[model samples]
Target: MPIDTTPNAAIQRSLRQCLSNAAFMLYQQGHVLETITIPFRGLDGSALRQLREASREWPACQQVLESSEAAVYNEHGRFVLTAMGRELLFDMFGQGAADCA
Candidate 1:
């Protein structure tokens, strides 16, 4: 039998919200300064898979992260943001706040 891959609406929203928040936080803390894949942990299998798969498409969420003010190339295997990413993070956070509604 095949695994049911479809994620529920709540899970999908949660995933996007989590990723946005995580990226913003990482930017604020200066952790993400390069292109890196955040270790797939903590999230459920579906969420993780969604992120992985989404990266394959154009203009991905990771791309948003990379395009931020503090983005950089991932020499190490860790999700990072460059200087621009940090600035962009502030913007993203601000925008995300509005999404809370």
Candidate 2:
């Protein structure tokens, strides 16, 4: 499969903005990205909009995000991290992303 290697500053910023909503420490099964969605408060409007725009073209965004291994909301409506996402989260926060959880 072809990968979108082009730099997507918008998506990257959106991903970072989404991550800002919740605190972090480390990642377990679904720690880092999961925190963005809670029963009471889900992703903020801006973050959601950003994601929507980034994901407007599913295949395109998939290639782009997957290339960078970013955390994304899958078609199943679940937030999942790619390989880079895990590493990125760990780099940003150590141990577990449960500080605010």
Candidate 3:
């Protein structure tokens, strides 16, 4: 069967919110991107699929996340952000050096 690739505003909003929340948590906890997980919150199947799709389309998401065999084993993969991902997050979110430090 063909997949439905149509964009859903609500899903986009939810996904963006999820990423933003994750970014904030990373900042607050002072956890480096390598230690942080994208899609940090538990999501329903549909939302998880959406998150995966968003990661593909967004550079920041792509840089920050990667899918691994571990995800399949865990039933929910935890993606660690790369150094570039951390830099991109701070840049996109306007977080200052002090904020991260």
Winning model by TM-score: 2
- Once superposed on the true structure, which residue ranges of model 1 sit more than 4 Å away at CA? 1-50, 53-59, 67-70, 94-101
Which window of ten consecutive residues has the lowest lDDT sum in model 1? 33-42
**Candidate 3 residues 1-101, lDDT tens each?**
87555665554444445456555554454454334423343333554455456444333443324331111112455444444444445555655532242
Which digits, one per residue and each the tens of the lDDT, describe model 1 over residues 28-85? 5343412123322123334435446544432355454454323344454334444344
Ranked by lDDT, the better of candidates 2 and 3 is: 2
Tens digit per residue, CA lDDT, model 2, 1-101: 87565657667765554344323221321234544333232344455445555444433443454455564565555445544555555566663642222
Q: Write down the worst ten-residue block by lDDT for model 3.
A: 65-74
Candidate 1 shows a clash count of 20
User: For each candidate, what is the lDDT?
Assistant: 0.42, 0.46, 0.43
